[model samples]
Target: MYALKEREMIFVFTGPHGAGRKTVAEMSGSTLGMKQVISYTTRPPKATEVDGQDYHFISPAQFVAAQADNEFIEVSTVNEHLYGIKSADIELMFQQSGSIYLILNRFGAQTLKKLYGEHVVQIFIYADRATLEERMRESGDSEELIAKYLSHYEDEMAYRDQCDHVFENVDLAHTVFDLTKTLDQNLNRNLLDLD
Candidate 1:
Protein backbone atom coordinates (compact mmCIF):
# COMPACT_ATOMS: atom_id res chain seq x y z
CA MET A 1 0.00 0.00 0.00
CA TYR A 2 1.15 3.48 -0.75
CA ALA A 3 1.36 6.16 1.90
CA LEU A 4 -1.56 8.56 2.10
CA LYS A 5 0.80 11.47 1.75
CA GLU A 6 1.91 10.30 -1.67
CA ARG A 7 0.15 11.90 -4.63
CA GLU A 8 -2.26 9.73 -6.56
CA MET A 9 -1.79 9.11 -10.28
CA ILE A 10 -4.56 8.05 -12.63
CA PHE A 11 -3.34 6.55 -15.88
CA VAL A 12 -5.98 6.48 -18.62
CA PHE A 13 -5.29 4.31 -21.65
CA THR A 14 -7.35 5.43 -24.61
CA GLY A 15 -7.47 4.02 -28.11
CA PRO A 16 -9.73 2.77 -30.83
CA HIS A 17 -10.85 -0.85 -30.82
CA GLY A 18 -8.14 -3.48 -31.51
CA ALA A 19 -5.32 -1.11 -30.56
CA GLY A 20 -4.20 -3.36 -27.66
CA ARG A 21 -4.90 -0.62 -25.11
CA LYS A 22 -6.18 -3.04 -22.48
CA THR A 23 -3.27 -5.46 -22.94
CA VAL A 24 -0.70 -2.68 -22.74
CA ALA A 25 -2.39 -1.18 -19.70
CA GLU A 26 -2.41 -4.55 -17.95
CA MET A 27 1.26 -5.20 -18.68
CA SER A 28 2.45 -1.73 -17.70
CA GLY A 29 0.21 -1.52 -14.65
CA SER A 30 1.45 -4.85 -13.38
CA THR A 31 5.06 -3.84 -13.97
CA LEU A 32 4.59 -0.49 -12.19
CA GLY A 33 2.44 -1.82 -9.31
CA MET A 34 -0.58 0.23 -10.34
CA LYS A 35 -4.02 -1.11 -9.48
CA GLN A 36 -6.20 -1.94 -12.48
CA VAL A 37 -9.64 -0.33 -12.26
CA ILE A 38 -12.02 -2.91 -13.60
CA SER A 39 -15.09 -1.41 -15.25
CA TYR A 40 -18.72 -2.54 -15.33
CA THR A 41 -20.20 -3.60 -18.63
CA THR A 42 -23.45 -4.91 -19.99
CA ARG A 43 -21.53 -6.86 -22.63
CA PRO A 44 -20.90 -10.54 -22.12
CA PRO A 45 -17.44 -11.68 -21.10
CA LYS A 46 -15.22 -13.08 -23.81
CA ALA A 47 -14.05 -16.71 -23.55
CA THR A 48 -10.65 -15.70 -22.19
CA GLU A 49 -12.01 -13.00 -19.87
CA VAL A 50 -12.73 -13.49 -16.20
CA ASP A 51 -15.65 -11.95 -14.35
CA GLY A 52 -14.67 -9.13 -11.97
CA GLN A 53 -11.19 -9.11 -13.48
CA ASP A 54 -11.66 -8.12 -17.10
CA TYR A 55 -14.96 -6.45 -16.33
CA HIS A 56 -17.88 -6.50 -13.94
CA PHE A 57 -20.32 -8.11 -16.33
CA ILE A 58 -23.92 -7.22 -15.62
CA SER A 59 -27.32 -7.19 -17.27
CA PRO A 60 -28.82 -4.15 -18.93
CA ALA A 61 -31.33 -3.80 -16.10
CA GLN A 62 -28.55 -3.75 -13.52
CA PHE A 63 -26.63 -1.19 -15.53
CA VAL A 64 -29.65 1.06 -15.84
CA ALA A 65 -30.38 0.72 -12.11
CA ALA A 66 -26.82 1.65 -11.19
CA GLN A 67 -26.90 4.57 -13.57
CA ALA A 68 -30.12 5.78 -12.01
CA ASP A 69 -28.38 5.83 -8.65
CA ASN A 70 -25.49 7.90 -10.10
CA GLU A 71 -23.01 5.15 -9.27
CA PHE A 72 -20.72 5.74 -12.20
CA ILE A 73 -18.16 8.47 -12.57
CA GLU A 74 -17.88 7.84 -16.31
CA VAL A 75 -20.08 5.89 -18.68
CA SER A 76 -20.10 5.22 -22.41
CA THR A 77 -21.95 3.08 -24.90
CA VAL A 78 -19.94 0.98 -27.34
CA ASN A 79 -21.37 -1.40 -29.93
CA GLU A 80 -24.81 -1.27 -28.33
CA HIS A 81 -23.45 -2.23 -24.88
CA LEU A 82 -23.04 0.04 -21.90
CA TYR A 83 -19.78 0.34 -19.95
CA GLY A 84 -19.09 2.39 -16.86
CA ILE A 85 -16.65 3.00 -14.04
CA LYS A 86 -18.31 3.09 -10.63
CA SER A 87 -17.32 6.02 -8.46
CA ALA A 88 -17.00 3.78 -5.41
CA ASP A 89 -14.65 1.42 -7.21
CA ILE A 90 -12.28 4.25 -8.03
CA GLU A 91 -12.24 5.38 -4.41
CA LEU A 92 -11.55 1.86 -3.18
CA MET A 93 -8.74 1.36 -5.67
CA PHE A 94 -7.17 4.63 -4.63
CA GLN A 95 -7.17 3.45 -1.04
CA GLN A 96 -5.46 0.21 -2.03
CA SER A 97 -2.92 1.74 -4.42
CA GLY A 98 -1.86 5.31 -4.97
CA SER A 99 -1.53 4.81 -8.72
CA ILE A 100 -4.18 3.19 -10.93
CA TYR A 101 -4.76 2.22 -14.55
CA LEU A 102 -8.02 2.65 -16.51
CA ILE A 103 -8.90 1.47 -20.00
CA LEU A 104 -11.39 3.99 -21.31
CA ASN A 105 -12.50 5.55 -24.55
CA ARG A 106 -11.45 9.03 -25.56
CA PHE A 107 -14.54 10.68 -24.08
CA GLY A 108 -14.23 8.83 -20.79
CA ALA A 109 -10.56 9.76 -20.60
CA GLN A 110 -11.47 13.39 -21.17
CA THR A 111 -14.01 13.24 -18.35
CA LEU A 112 -11.43 11.85 -15.94
CA LYS A 113 -8.79 14.40 -16.97
CA LYS A 114 -11.32 17.15 -16.33
CA LEU A 115 -12.09 15.75 -12.89
CA TYR A 116 -8.54 15.01 -11.73
CA GLY A 117 -6.65 17.74 -13.62
CA GLU A 118 -2.91 17.11 -13.64
CA HIS A 119 -3.21 13.86 -11.72
CA VAL A 120 -4.70 12.24 -14.80
CA VAL A 121 -2.23 10.99 -17.42
CA GLN A 122 -3.77 10.19 -20.77
CA ILE A 123 -1.92 7.72 -23.03
CA PHE A 124 -3.01 7.01 -26.58
CA ILE A 125 -2.01 3.79 -28.32
CA TYR A 126 -2.73 3.18 -31.96
CA ALA A 127 -2.22 0.83 -34.90
CA ASP A 128 -2.92 1.06 -38.60
CA ARG A 129 -6.45 0.38 -39.84
CA ALA A 130 -5.44 -2.80 -41.64
CA THR A 131 -3.72 -4.11 -38.50
CA LEU A 132 -6.75 -3.16 -36.40
CA GLU A 133 -9.11 -4.99 -38.71
CA GLU A 134 -6.90 -8.06 -38.72
CA ARG A 135 -6.68 -7.99 -34.93
CA MET A 136 -10.44 -7.72 -34.54
CA ARG A 137 -10.94 -10.62 -36.90
CA GLU A 138 -8.47 -12.72 -34.94
CA SER A 139 -10.21 -11.80 -31.68
CA GLY A 140 -13.47 -13.24 -33.06
CA ASP A 141 -15.30 -10.02 -33.62
CA SER A 142 -18.10 -10.26 -36.17
CA GLU A 143 -17.66 -8.48 -39.49
CA GLU A 144 -20.61 -6.22 -38.73
CA LEU A 145 -19.21 -5.39 -35.30
CA ILE A 146 -15.81 -4.63 -36.75
CA ALA A 147 -17.38 -2.30 -39.26
CA LYS A 148 -19.23 -0.45 -36.53
CA TYR A 149 -16.03 0.00 -34.50
CA LEU A 150 -14.00 0.99 -37.52
CA SER A 151 -16.51 3.64 -38.51
CA HIS A 152 -15.35 5.68 -35.54
CA TYR A 153 -11.65 5.06 -36.09
CA GLU A 154 -10.88 8.49 -37.46
CA ASP A 155 -12.84 10.20 -34.70
CA GLU A 156 -11.00 8.23 -32.04
CA MET A 157 -7.62 8.90 -33.61
CA ALA A 158 -8.41 12.61 -33.52
CA TYR A 159 -7.89 12.56 -29.76
CA ARG A 160 -4.37 11.18 -29.96
CA ASP A 161 -2.83 14.62 -29.93
CA GLN A 162 -4.75 15.49 -26.77
CA CYS A 163 -3.06 12.72 -24.79
CA ASP A 164 -0.14 13.36 -22.49
CA HIS A 165 1.74 10.49 -24.09
CA VAL A 166 1.23 8.64 -27.37
CA PHE A 167 2.60 5.24 -28.40
CA GLU A 168 2.46 3.18 -31.54
CA ASN A 169 1.84 -0.43 -30.51
CA VAL A 170 3.66 -2.29 -33.26
CA ASP A 171 5.41 -4.70 -30.88
CA LEU A 172 3.76 -5.60 -27.57
CA ALA A 173 7.01 -6.16 -25.66
CA HIS A 174 8.60 -2.97 -26.87
CA THR A 175 5.43 -0.94 -26.25
CA VAL A 176 5.13 -2.29 -22.70
CA PHE A 177 8.77 -1.47 -21.98
CA ASP A 178 8.37 2.06 -23.28
CA LEU A 179 5.13 2.61 -21.37
CA THR A 180 6.71 1.39 -18.12
CA LYS A 181 9.78 3.56 -18.62
CA THR A 182 7.67 6.64 -19.35
CA LEU A 183 5.59 6.10 -16.25
CA ASP A 184 8.70 5.59 -14.11
CA GLN A 185 10.17 8.85 -15.30
CA ASN A 186 6.88 10.66 -14.67
CA LEU A 187 6.64 9.11 -11.22
CA ASN A 188 10.12 10.23 -10.33
CA ARG A 189 9.49 13.72 -11.61
CA ASN A 190 6.21 13.91 -9.71
CA LEU A 191 7.88 12.74 -6.50
CA LEU A 192 10.47 15.49 -6.76
CA ASP A 193 7.82 18.11 -7.57
CA LEU A 194 5.65 16.99 -4.69
CA ASP A 195 8.59 17.15 -2.27
Candidate 2:
Protein backbone atom coordinates (compact mmCIF):
# COMPACT_ATOMS: atom_id res chain seq x y z
CA MET A 1 0.00 0.00 0.00
CA TYR A 2 1.92 2.96 -1.34
CA ALA A 3 1.07 6.03 -3.34
CA LEU A 4 1.35 5.80 -7.07
CA LYS A 5 4.48 7.21 -8.65
CA GLU A 6 5.92 7.38 -12.11
CA ARG A 7 5.83 3.97 -13.76
CA GLU A 8 9.09 2.05 -13.52
CA MET A 9 10.90 -0.60 -15.48
CA ILE A 10 11.29 -4.19 -14.27
CA PHE A 11 14.73 -5.79 -14.15
CA VAL A 12 14.83 -9.57 -14.20
CA PHE A 13 18.09 -11.40 -13.45
CA THR A 14 18.08 -14.97 -14.60
CA GLY A 15 20.66 -17.74 -14.63
CA PRO A 16 21.65 -21.09 -13.17
CA HIS A 17 21.23 -21.55 -9.43
CA GLY A 18 24.08 -20.36 -7.18
CA ALA A 19 25.33 -17.99 -9.85
CA GLY A 20 24.83 -14.95 -7.59
CA ARG A 21 21.83 -13.54 -9.40
CA LYS A 22 20.18 -12.45 -6.18
CA THR A 23 23.36 -10.88 -4.85
CA VAL A 24 23.91 -8.82 -7.98
CA ALA A 25 20.26 -7.80 -8.12
CA GLU A 26 20.39 -6.63 -4.51
CA MET A 27 23.55 -4.63 -5.12
CA SER A 28 22.21 -3.07 -8.30
CA GLY A 29 18.84 -2.19 -6.78
CA SER A 30 20.31 -0.66 -3.66
CA THR A 31 22.93 1.34 -5.57
CA LEU A 32 20.51 2.59 -8.20
CA GLY A 33 17.77 3.84 -5.86
CA MET A 34 15.38 1.13 -7.02
CA LYS A 35 13.59 -1.41 -4.88
CA GLN A 36 13.50 -5.17 -5.20
CA VAL A 37 10.28 -7.17 -5.47
CA ILE A 38 10.41 -9.56 -2.55
CA SER A 39 9.02 -12.72 -3.97
CA TYR A 40 6.65 -15.26 -2.41
CA THR A 41 7.82 -18.77 -1.80
CA THR A 42 6.53 -21.99 -0.38
CA ARG A 43 10.01 -22.81 0.81
CA PRO A 44 11.38 -21.91 4.20
CA PRO A 45 13.83 -19.04 4.61
CA LYS A 46 17.55 -19.56 4.56
CA ALA A 47 19.61 -18.75 7.64
CA THR A 48 20.53 -15.33 6.26
CA GLU A 49 17.18 -14.38 4.71
CA VAL A 50 14.75 -12.11 6.50
CA ASP A 51 11.11 -13.15 6.30
CA GLY A 52 9.06 -10.39 4.75
CA GLN A 53 11.97 -8.50 3.29
CA ASP A 54 13.55 -11.36 1.40
CA TYR A 55 10.50 -13.41 0.53
CA HIS A 56 6.95 -13.90 1.71
CA PHE A 57 7.45 -17.38 3.02
CA ILE A 58 4.11 -19.15 3.06
CA SER A 59 2.52 -22.56 3.37
CA PRO A 60 1.81 -24.84 0.44
CA ALA A 61 -1.92 -24.25 0.83
CA GLN A 62 -1.42 -20.51 0.89
CA PHE A 63 0.77 -20.63 -2.18
CA VAL A 64 -1.73 -22.83 -3.99
CA ALA A 65 -4.57 -20.51 -3.10
CA ALA A 66 -2.68 -17.52 -4.41
CA GLN A 67 -1.90 -19.38 -7.58
CA ALA A 68 -5.56 -20.32 -8.02
CA ASP A 69 -6.46 -16.69 -7.51
CA ASN A 70 -3.98 -15.71 -10.22
CA GLU A 71 -1.99 -13.53 -7.83
CA PHE A 72 1.38 -14.39 -9.29
CA ILE A 73 2.99 -12.72 -12.28
CA GLU A 74 5.16 -15.77 -12.74
CA VAL A 75 5.75 -19.03 -10.90
CA SER A 76 8.28 -21.82 -11.08
CA THR A 77 9.10 -24.94 -9.13
CA VAL A 78 12.72 -25.54 -8.23
CA ASN A 79 13.94 -28.42 -6.10
CA GLU A 80 10.35 -28.92 -4.97
CA HIS A 81 10.14 -25.33 -3.72
CA LEU A 82 7.77 -22.93 -5.43
CA TYR A 83 8.93 -19.37 -6.12
CA GLY A 84 6.84 -16.59 -7.53
CA ILE A 85 6.24 -12.86 -7.68
CA LYS A 86 2.90 -11.58 -6.52
CA SER A 87 1.17 -8.91 -8.56
CA ALA A 88 0.24 -7.03 -5.41
CA ASP A 89 3.89 -6.91 -4.34
CA ILE A 90 4.91 -5.59 -7.72
CA GLU A 91 2.32 -2.83 -7.66
CA LEU A 92 3.46 -1.81 -4.22
CA MET A 93 7.11 -1.78 -5.30
CA PHE A 94 6.30 0.42 -8.29
CA GLN A 95 4.32 2.81 -6.14
CA GLN A 96 7.05 3.07 -3.54
CA SER A 97 10.25 3.03 -5.64
CA GLY A 98 9.31 3.61 -9.29
CA SER A 99 11.20 0.49 -10.38
CA ILE A 100 11.93 -3.05 -9.23
CA TYR A 101 14.74 -5.59 -9.52
CA LEU A 102 14.13 -9.30 -9.20
CA ILE A 103 15.77 -12.70 -9.56
CA LEU A 104 14.03 -15.48 -11.43
CA ASN A 105 14.67 -18.65 -13.35
CA ARG A 106 14.91 -18.69 -17.12
CA PHE A 107 11.21 -19.43 -17.63
CA GLY A 108 10.13 -16.75 -15.22
CA ALA A 109 12.36 -14.19 -16.90
CA GLN A 110 11.01 -15.05 -20.31
CA THR A 111 7.44 -14.81 -19.06
CA LEU A 112 8.07 -11.39 -17.57
CA LYS A 113 9.70 -10.14 -20.75
CA LYS A 114 6.77 -11.34 -22.82
CA LEU A 115 4.28 -9.81 -20.40
CA TYR A 116 5.91 -6.41 -19.95
CA GLY A 117 7.59 -5.97 -23.32
CA GLU A 118 9.80 -2.86 -23.32
CA HIS A 119 9.33 -2.24 -19.63
CA VAL A 120 11.35 -5.38 -18.80
CA VAL A 121 15.16 -5.52 -18.91
CA GLN A 122 16.51 -9.03 -18.74
CA ILE A 123 20.04 -9.76 -17.48
CA PHE A 124 21.54 -13.22 -17.50
CA ILE A 125 24.26 -14.11 -14.97
CA TYR A 126 26.29 -17.28 -15.13
CA ALA A 127 29.55 -18.83 -13.94
CA ASP A 128 31.79 -21.67 -15.01
CA ARG A 129 30.32 -25.13 -14.37
CA ALA A 130 32.95 -25.89 -11.78
CA THR A 131 32.23 -22.69 -9.93
CA LEU A 132 28.50 -23.36 -10.10
CA GLU A 133 28.89 -26.86 -8.68
CA GLU A 134 31.13 -25.63 -5.91
CA ARG A 135 28.81 -22.82 -4.96
CA MET A 136 25.83 -25.11 -4.93
CA ARG A 137 27.63 -27.47 -2.64
CA GLU A 138 28.65 -24.66 -0.35
CA SER A 139 25.08 -23.42 -0.27
CA GLY A 140 24.00 -26.81 1.13
CA ASP A 141 22.07 -28.01 -1.84
CA SER A 142 21.87 -31.78 -2.01
CA GLU A 143 23.24 -33.93 -4.79
CA GLU A 144 19.81 -34.42 -6.33
CA LEU A 145 19.01 -30.75 -6.27
CA ILE A 146 22.37 -29.92 -7.76
CA ALA A 147 21.74 -32.41 -10.49
CA LYS A 148 18.39 -30.81 -11.23
CA TYR A 149 20.11 -27.46 -11.55
CA LEU A 150 22.68 -28.94 -13.86
CA SER A 151 19.93 -30.26 -16.10
CA HIS A 152 18.73 -26.71 -16.63
CA TYR A 153 22.13 -25.36 -17.64
CA GLU A 154 21.56 -25.86 -21.33
CA ASP A 155 18.26 -24.03 -21.24
CA GLU A 156 19.70 -21.19 -19.23
CA MET A 157 22.46 -20.76 -21.75
CA ALA A 158 20.07 -20.74 -24.69
CA TYR A 159 17.94 -18.08 -22.99
CA ARG A 160 20.97 -15.83 -22.60
CA ASP A 161 20.65 -14.84 -26.23
CA GLN A 162 17.23 -13.37 -25.50
CA CYS A 163 18.47 -11.23 -22.63
CA ASP A 164 19.52 -7.59 -22.91
CA HIS A 165 22.78 -8.25 -21.08
CA VAL A 166 24.80 -11.26 -19.92
CA PHE A 167 27.73 -11.62 -17.55
CA GLU A 168 29.77 -14.22 -15.72
CA ASN A 169 29.62 -13.54 -11.99
CA VAL A 170 33.17 -14.44 -11.06
CA ASP A 171 34.02 -11.37 -9.00
CA LEU A 172 31.13 -9.91 -7.04
CA ALA A 173 32.39 -6.33 -6.93
CA HIS A 174 33.24 -6.29 -10.60
CA THR A 175 29.90 -7.82 -11.57
CA VAL A 176 28.06 -5.27 -9.49
CA PHE A 177 30.01 -2.43 -11.09
CA ASP A 178 29.42 -3.72 -14.60
CA LEU A 179 25.72 -4.33 -13.96
CA THR A 180 25.27 -0.91 -12.40
CA LYS A 181 26.90 0.83 -15.34
CA THR A 182 24.88 -1.10 -17.91
CA LEU A 183 21.65 -0.52 -16.01
CA ASP A 184 22.32 3.20 -15.67
CA GLN A 185 22.95 3.46 -19.36
CA ASN A 186 19.76 1.60 -20.23
CA LEU A 187 17.60 3.57 -17.80
CA ASN A 188 19.01 6.83 -19.10
CA ARG A 189 18.44 5.72 -22.65
CA ASN A 190 14.84 4.90 -21.83
CA LEU A 191 14.32 8.28 -20.23
CA LEU A 192 15.69 10.14 -23.24
CA ASP A 193 13.85 8.01 -25.76
CA LEU A 194 10.49 8.79 -24.13
CA ASP A 195 9.79 11.55 -26.57
Q: Which candidate leads the pack in lDDT?
A: 1
Candidate 1 structure quality by residue, lDDT tens digits, 89-182: 8888998887888999998999888877888899999999999999999999889989999999999999999999999999999999888889
As a TM-score, model 2 comes out at 0.88
Model 2: residues with Cα > 4 Å off, grouped in runs:
1-7, 189-195
lDDT of 2 by residue, 52-116 (tens): 88788999999999999998878999778999888888887787776788888888898888778
Q: lDDT score of model 1?
A: 0.89
- Candidate 2 lowest-lDDT run of ten: 186-195
Question: How much lDDT does each candidate structure score?
Answer: 0.89, 0.85
Candidate that would win on TM-score: 1
